[model samples]
Target: MFSSKSERLFTGMIAAALAVSAVTPVVSVEAKQSEKVTYQAKKQETIEILAPTSPLVFKQGEKLKGKDRILNVKIDGKVKKQPVRWSNLTTSTIGEFTATATYSHKGQTVTLDVPYTVEGYELAIMHTNDTHASLDNAPKRATAVNQLREENANRLLIDAGDVFSGSLYFNKFKGQADLTLMNYMQYDLMVPGNHEFDLGTEAGHPEFAEFIQNAEFPFVSSNVDYSGDQYLNALYSEDLTHKPVDGKLYEGVIKTIDGKKVGFFGLTTEDTANIASPGPIQFQHYIDEAEKAVKSFKQRGVDQIVAVSHLGFDDNPAVDNDLELAKRVEGIDVIIGGHSHSRLNEPVVVADGAEPTVIVQAYQYGDFLGTLDVVFDQNGKIVSHQGKLIDVKTYAADPTAVSLLAPFAQEIESIRNAEIGAEATAAFDNPRDAGDVTKPSVRKNETALGNLITDGMLDRAKQMDGEVVAAIQNAGGIRAPINAGPITTGEVLTTLPFGNTLAVMTLDGSELLSALERSVSVYPIESGGFLHMSGMKVEFDSSKPANSRIVKAQVLKDGQYVDVVPTETYKIATNYFAAKGGDNYLEFKKAYEEGRVNDLGIIDWEIMRDYLVKLQTVTPSVEGRILDVK
Candidate 1:
């Protein structure tokens, strides 16, 4: 709530106490993150809450562990064998519980709050988000999940969506095989992401509704309302007594977790309209729908609430991220979110005191599994929350997941002409200029993958009907590194997972220059709009003022590099997202609106794959196409 500069600096200190990085973590189960509790009182002993970083899952019909390790008490900078006294232990029901650790020294007593979740049903709530069908990690993820399930008697698995598009797996099976594997994992509930509808309106592709109907788990969406398709209407559920605020579609549902009614609702971002073709499916406001669901849960006397959300956690407040949702509405206890590809090492608490919400998300590609252990007070309000991000690759992949995925792998191998499944001849590296992995080159200046992508687009555009001279791809579109060694279809998809179709747009030299200027406006901060180009050489100073950063620009014309002519028209190739004003490429959007941009309707992956096949062996090097003369 800081307005002035001085106030902002003061409030910044307050934020550190709540959401500080892993070191010297200071938070209690009872008090929310916003409240500043005094710990400087004289004559007090501090106790270290030493609990294991692993998730503490309790399953139904499973024996509870004896003598759980709560915490070690310390008095006046000395470690004691045990805490003076332990309080708050009840085993009658399954719910999140907390205990108090007490120690006495120098006529003063200090108390520490220790929390644990008790259960009569399941031990772990395992979830993954934004996997993007990178099935190569499927075996590794399954390995981690299976080991966790073995130790915990009861387990609940869920997904936060975007299990569509990416690798050859989705390209060949179209989400059917992804669902088959998810079914094998026994996911309890799943929500649809914007990418789930990437093929919804297209012909000859499996629609999202079809995936929903075939899915073993329930697809929940508190804000999405659609009933044109009979199959969708029959399967969709609005079972919660209270409807979402102004929602004409399905709300949330009450699922039995830990032998208790835990109200679980789903919310996808409203931006689905522009991102994907969600035919007949309309979205309701995110915060309003969440508030409505919370009200309904409270009315039904449900204490624990979990929202499986795809509403991303972005810096833009206008986008309605998970943190903003928690702040805007009260009553939600935990929010498992997706769509931003954010990997939160620890769960974040937005405890501005109105029913504090704990938010957690795993990084994309099934590389990590998110685990959040929440303890609810007697009144059902969350008292304590602990979060952990498990590295799936740390353990051996389970054989079951590998077996289940084998058939699809075989199918993809055949369709790839045995090339996509096989390894590539050379390696493509994307590292920082300082020879470090800290900051990737793609987001800042330019990398080999960015060059390769734009080069493919330019090559493909030249093959098509037009005088296409250049290609540009926003940095954000490149998802991951190609790494080294043999490149499989999986690796290629991992690098370009978005499945953005290529568009060859007509842009005059002036507009092109404007586009390049906008691309580097927020230079060092890492913007997705930063353009990677082929057939053009751009030399710019990032320190220069925005919209005027370009020191020089050139395009290949008639087999030679020449200065760009402002009035000269050229057909430039770029992705659909950039062409439609995504990442704030307004010039491209304007061109599309003016009918100057023609969407070639060519898929981007094909261009890259075809380029790779033709080359057979590639040794791409950065030769100053995008120079940062800082």
Candidate 2:
């Protein structure tokens, strides 16, 4: 559920009108044949009122309210454009009266029989977020949404983004085939996620551009500045605007449904600066931008504002979360959120004033479709809402997406089933602990597994004509703790599933010291702290905070341990993800900017697996060589 300013005003006007309606009454007016007299009065006491030049001119089931007229009415069901003749007015004063009104559609008019019962309309909002291209139905999520569409004719299908750059299928297809899947499903509107920029920001693929060009929907983002990037600028520049991320430019979109105007907009988290290759992309404050967008929508007279945001939900009760945004921002009626992959099985209702705003999100990877059923009363204020995470697993797969994805299914299944090797015991239980990397077997400095992987990368890099002087791997990317028993290829793949390529760079001993200092000074608990190196020994103090943890950094030169001096550069090997500085290693991102990084053109997992296979029988042991922590 998302909201814009017009929605708030519409809800407010409805509430005001409903409040004023209680004092009004419906009264019938009688006119003589010779003179036409209009009875326009305060009529404060009248509860039901009907007035016309002739009794036969009135119609049944048509809502009419003058300065002071209220009538008890009910609609039996929907009717086409036609004149409904009423035989009774049912006013306290007038016993019975005859009335009729003409209804028409597409220039055709007719008369229809009137019913005694009343009927109302229902609004359904259907959305999906974080769909990272689970393109095939073998996973069963892609087919589930297609099946759910059967329930509502006036339905909206929206993706909150992150629809690119994941899985072997996407890596193989480069998003051309992924867009085809969304095209076939007919998504009405979409926003791009960080991964959408993966193709070096090129819109040169005419086929890909043609698909988005032919979309029956719009791709909206208020944050991205594309003036520098021609590829993306040509494809989606027009829809771009300055909006907010953490606190900056928030823009909302306007859409009309069933003759009632509805508005929606989206925001992505600012964390992309670290998570993806953002490259000159700028982000703004999300809440501030949202506030401005709402104010703009209010000026336009469009109501029923919905905010489709990718800011992610805040689960920690201790954090002053975005649920605060709903209460803090006055006009927004609902928030449809994603990122952080949360599951909202029911709507989180936060009271505003007379009406409360609803927040909802389904878990990620097409496991569910979030359905929010909102009913706004005659005054435009939401009376009730029901949120549901429609389980995709429950529905049988739709054959079309399944059939389209069948060919690639076997490869994925094979990868998932492949066996790697046997383990004697689990390597370590606390893989997430930053301190785990400082311990004997799991410590990046001494862990047999870490040494094994870095050695592999060095071997691969050496094959590329680059002698590996240094090698480093972030412990966080090591997924499963290597078990002591059988380790299958499936386990290895799961541990290093991200398909990151290895990169080799030339760095001075001084620069290497800087890199080590940055890595050791930061105790990243479960992330960004553990450093596995092949040619360097880094010592850090545990008593020190992460930013200043490094005690001593040194490198081996011709088998001699030399203290790192400030100006020396050394050639090093690492993964492209780290070379790009993914793990708060802004120093690496800076290094790339300074022209100090080079790609070795080898996949990280391939090297590690090869290194493990060299030994027919492998047993990992801890030798406290890397860390001399005291």
Candidate 3:
């Protein structure tokens, strides 16, 4: 240094320089630490926890683990999946619960109070089939529905069709009376049965159209083509819709229940074209339409499918049926069926495939309400199910339904109580061989009621076409019985409620013989085609084969039983239903098509009522009209 002070100053300056260099290094280190801390805080703010698309719903008694409980973490606008650590999740109870889900990502942990549900996911379906306008017990049915709905919020009330005919309610009101209560009970969906088309030919289904238009719920019909019918086509939607409007008709519908999509389609028997007056309405092949419906539902991401089928349970192997549908279709989960009027006390499960299809049907009348509770797994597959028929009569009448039904019941009461000026000598029992197969039944054997009905039909047909020789009545056409008292107009209406007109057909003796063979084809099994004779008698051997069962055939010629000449042409009378191939009367259908048949345009119940008035004191008995020998 230059001097002692200067040297000290230079030394101090050098010391200060050294101090500044060391301090500068320390400040640079602290600034970098602050920046690192700020970056860590910003990164922690960008890391957000996102819940799953589907709600975290766990089954009862299921432990929360695996990928199902994983949470998605969003980091810097990118999603990152991470397993969530859930706080003490109690799934033993079935209800809503809140729990904390801890998600950790990139050394940052997030604890969220996520809401979840632990439930059995039991779907309750309340169904009915073939109620057939039996509204006498509708109030009780409403009560049953209300009680069941109260028990479970997840429930659907559906009808499998045939709510159009069979009782005084349909006779007078043309389904309006039933509709009032059905609306009150809130039916979710309904399918049209064959009988729904009964009035199609008369007025192009004016009453049916009105019934459907005024309905509170929608209709699903996949196989029936309403496009041909002017009245129905307007309301018909060929496209499957997720949100279907009430009172409209659809090929299929997607119903969202409990955050899950359930698909529904409907099918009526193709035999409806022959059995009922569908008029311009066309019926497609059921299997084909059902396949299309399932495909459509699946394309829309619906897994659970329900078919409301009017096909019989195990009716005709030649025709379509629910059993065949269940076996053939792959994705259908449940079938609520009608037409055969099967009383499924428990659900029938078809488990031949990977998944099972459950089938249930209530009996003919509003006698029972079918209930099915299906438990679905997390994958939307049916894990377990329980189904049963609840007797409508078991429940107390609902006050609201009773109030709704009062006016209808009052009007029906007046018509039902009016006497027809005829007294029955005995109770004309319309027996069925349901419990005891060996006993005589109206469907399998000639009963007094069948004889009376056929006699009335013959007498009425002779008035229209005097040449009409014999009258044949399908036993299935006879619905109810005439009590052993003063017969009322309601009794006759209930007995022959289908509103079938008289038809006279000209058939060769050979064709008549073929008809007789067809009638007795299913003889010990109680076929609906069983012929009840008024002017003919047939003896058949039950031990013989089906088509060759007839042993002898006779026709009443000039009030005498004579042998049927195969070469001779004869005139026969039957209901329009049978004349037009109903109950598989092919010969009658042939005659109808060949212009050899004449429809009298008279209602069958009116014909029976007039015949009863003519007979004054009605005492009819079975006179060995149909003989079956071993």
Q: Pick the candidate with the highest lDDT.
A: 3
Model 3: how far residue 339 lies from native, Å: 1.3
Q: Report lDDT per candidate.
A: 0.71, 0.57, 0.82
lDDT per residue, candidate 3, 363-433, as tens digits?
76788999998876545567789999998897889998999999988998998889989999989999998
- In candidate 1, what are the lDDT values of residues 209-275, reduced to their tens digit? 6787677666668988766544356556677833322211246767655556688889988877655
TM-score of each: 0.59, 0.52, 0.63
Model 2, C-alpha of 268: deviation from truth (Å) = 1.3
Which has the greatest TM-score? Answer: 3
Candidate 3 accuracy as lDDT: 0.82
Badly placed stretches (over 4 Å) of model 1 are 1-124, 202-206, 241-250, 418-452, 455-531, 534-537, 540-550, 553-630
lDDT of 2 at 299: 70
Q: What's the lDDT for residue 95 in model 1?
A: 67
What residue runs in model 2 are displaced by over 4 Å at the alpha carbon?
1-121, 136-139, 198-216, 237-252, 315-321, 352-355, 407-491, 495-619, 624-630
RMSD of each: 19.4, 16.8, 13.5
TM-score ranking, best first: 3, 1, 2
Q: Report the C-alpha lDDT of model 2 over 1-630, residue by residue, as the tens digit.
A: 234542321111110111124442333333222223333332222111222323222222335445112222212232222223333433222113333333323332223222232222235777787666565443355565556667676777777776665565565555555566666666666655555554443323232344356555666565555545544445543322323121112244566665456667666665554345555456666667677767777677755777776665652212223476677777777777775456789988889645688888876666688888876543345666787887777767666766666666666677555654434354533233335644433323446677667767777676664456667887766666556565666666666765566676666665666677666554433344467877667777767765566677766567776677767667778876687666777777667545566543344665666666665356565554366475
How does candidate 2 fare on TM-score?
Answer: 0.52
Worst 10 residues of 2 by lDDT: 10-19
